[model samples]
Target: MYSSIELENVEPRELEEEAPTLLSVGRELKPEKMRPNVWHYERGEENAYHRQGEQEELYVVLEGTVDVTIERDDERDVITLSKHDVLVVPPESWRQLRAVEESRVLAVGAPNVPDDGMLEE
Candidate 1:
């Protein structure tokens, strides 16, 4: 069971219009072995501010440290994660990811509601 692309191999696409470091990989590497999931984001950025609407998400910090801020209901919280650390964001909670240094982050979410993720305005 292997479906892989060097995440970094994703060529220049319309996504470069969004962010040079953002690569839309979930569709291109859909694994037949697993249920469809909302796109998996392979990000190499200093920070990313966004959130999921209908699905909870797991943030896997592959390198460096990331400050995760989640805003829900009327409260907000922040967590610091380093290499190998993982943070789970519940549905509808607003989240912001800021890398303390050059970093790689893989965000995974289940049951593809492909259109449910929205970036902050």
Candidate 2:
């Protein structure tokens, strides 16, 4: 059996308090090995600084622009991504994303472990 659903049809999930709108694509699609999410950010909205224990994530900017900050070993790097831009982040690297404008992003991560993420203060 196969399943198909349009992105616009899925309801947003309240995964983060006071954060961007999140659509859980993997939850709707039910893929076995990966988790995918679509995030809609208003201007100045941002996610928290966090890292995953075993999941490597790929983020693609679907609309507008965002600034992704990555931290590793006391060093931090900020990367600006526009539409169609992609960023790959390693499992242990902490990352945060802030919207430069109203934007949409597609984030896919492997292994799909729900409890493997850690947030920084």
Question: Which candidate has the highest TM-score of all?
Answer: 2
lDDT (CA) for every model shown? 0.64, 0.92
lDDT tens per residue, model 1, 27-106: 66874432222222234443346666777777787767767888988798888888899777887888877666666667
Collision pairs in model 2? none
lDDT, model 1: 0.64
TM-score of each: 0.72, 0.94
Off by over 4 Å in 2: none
Segments in model 1 whose C-alpha atoms lie over 4 Å from true places: 12-20, 32-48, 119-121
lDDT of 2 by residue, 9-90 (tens): 9899766464899988888999888888899999999987799989999999999999999999999999999999999999
Best-performing candidate as measured by lDDT: 2
